[model samples]
Target: MLCCFALSLVACATVPHTGRKQLNFVSDKQLNSIGAKAYSEILKREPVSENKTLNETVKRVADRIGKVADETDKPGFEWDVRLIDQDIPNAFCLPGGKIIVYKGILPYAKTEAGLAAIIGHEVAHAVARHGAERLSQQMALQGVGAVGSEIFKSTDGKLDEKTRAIIGALGFGATIGVILPYSRTHEFEADRIGQTYMASAGYEPEEAVKLWSRMSAIKKPPIPPWLSTHPADQDRVNKLIESSPDAQKKYQEVRDKIGLGVQLDVLMDQSDRQ
Candidate 1:
């Protein structure tokens, strides 16, 4: 009881999505391993992009976006960006520099700023370690704190799906927790933080709003997986625009310091070439 009480107050976390202090009971290592394993399994099941043009576009865009983080004081993030030649328009960043962009997002991204919006958002999720934080919260919510510790211990450095499922079972009370609840709060957090990341990456924060506008337009037939998990697009876009005044100003000020309209132009130029 005393340990649980201490854990509750001592775990002061600054949410990457909102810059707010939140109670995070999950360990960073556990989060990374889970992301890594999930990413690996997904890759094995689906063919990753072998397209040269796609690869070049994603890398160029990723480089530009990653730089914005340094300008905004987000340091020490080892970044690796790759493009996957899938039909789905989606992207995600795993803890410790793993990132993937699908070709489907290209049509919607249209420009470097748009790509920045997507990558920045994914990176925010990783930097904030939201996945792990959610698992920690899940354990607390269930009053099974020991499961949280087990998750941390078993799913670090290197992990497989079986290990992931085991950890998920303990903390989440079901292997399907990750698939079922899908952590809606975490998605919201990533959106807020992703907006900041894009701004820092030298993209207009409003472009995130625009990107979501495109997302809102996604076709109804197949109903892509990203849409299913991502919150209501219009509402998210509105929040971004409402928050844009401050974020856009910061981006403008940064660009002016370097003498340009969004240093992201270079990446756009690179992507256009590809």
Candidate 2:
């Protein structure tokens, strides 16, 4: 057991740019295979957008940001992007770089730069292997709990009610104290890394802050950050503001800055439907 722990410590991975250490026992091949299967199933169920404008916009933004991510992380991901005709403001990049952008998010995106920020953030999650890191965390926690159960097993070979209750309480505490906070950390890390990606991709990093501002305006009532898997909207915006100067420096270094690119027109889609 000690040797296994020692090997795990030696095998820890470091996140590029952020330099954060990650404990991911899950192999990239395994995670990416699962992600590919899931992405295929999701695409089969979701109505992929046939709108040429939307498809072009999503694909373009994803391509630019994906290139930057590839250069930065060398994750060897096979990047693909699709625009889904959904009414929810959602976007996600699964492992191996499969990105899905929902139509409802176009209103929030506002411009090409805004879309870049969103795609950059999701791609950051993928390149950083946040999904695998999270799964590793869960596996480790469950293993610890299982070990504890065996160690504390009663003479009758079962945990007493009190011991079971104690284990459950510890599980809840770990969820609240470790898992929730780690999820929020992943989000904040993605936000920071995403700014670098957009800036390096020739999109203004400030658009990320603006994108969050627009989304927050419509956000529902807040929950305390400690109890939630995501940071409060205001807190996220503040951190972005704090991180913008460095991102700006990266943007300035790009020889062919695209600035904000083209403005998005969700109204046109609405009109077509009418």
Candidate 3:
């Protein structure tokens, strides 16, 4: 127990930009290995997008976002992005900077800037090491439960199976009740950092707000905020709108240094014609 606690203290680290303290005992290599394996498994199960132009566009935007993330957030990450032929309106970035975009999300993303918002946000989750932090927290909680069980066993009285079951339930409750809220915090932090990345990459940051607003309007049954893993769409949209001005300033600076970004609509139209 003492050893695990000591390790947790030593492994404490702060997230970039957000400056939030996180307990991450997992090593980058370990997390990356897990991410890589999972990514490979997913690719084997799901078909990669065959539309050449759409695939090219996804790579292009992802490359720009990945470059900025490398410079400011996660340097030397083995960044790779691919478009999957799925109709689900979802995307994700794995620990080693591997990103997969589902085809169904393209319509909602609307333009290159909108797609950048989605990619940037997902990549931000990786750059911020949210996955590692969550794993570390779970491990720590399990360790705590183990220690408690040990202490109970050492006592003069024997603990019944019912008592053990109660201890397990407490751990489960802690995970859902306490840890889930922390996950929501990570999502909001990712949204903020993601917009900044989009700006730094020469994409319009305000598009993030627009992207989420569109997401809010998408037809879907609502889940209560407390029971869901992600923040409510309206709440997320509000935060993105509030934070976009700062991101826009960064975008303007990047635009001044470089030429205008690629035209997403033209590229999409071209893809459609093909």
Off by over 4 Å in 1: 1-7, 40-43, 70-76, 143-185, 256-274
| Candidate number with the higher lDDT (1 or 3) | 3
TM-score of predicted structure 2: 0.77
Question: Clashing pairs in model 3?
Answer: none
- Whole-model lDDT per candidate: 0.61, 0.71, 0.71
Q: Give the 10-residue window scoring lowest on summed lDDT in candidate 3.
A: 170-179
Give the alpha carbon lDDT tens digit for every residue of 1-274 in model 2: 3333654685478888888888777677766765575467567767998888778878989999999988888989999999889765666777788887788777778888898998898788888887767655655656633223232323343545434433232211121122233366788898999999999998989999998776656555543222233334788899999999999998988836565567776544553775
lDDT of 1: 0.61
Candidate 2 ranges with C-alpha deviation above 4 Å: 1-7, 144-182, 221-232, 255-259, 266-274
Candidate 1: residue 192 Cα off by (Å): 2.9
TM-scores for every candidate against the unseen true structure: 0.73, 0.77, 0.77
lDDT of 2: 0.71
RMSD of 2: 8.7
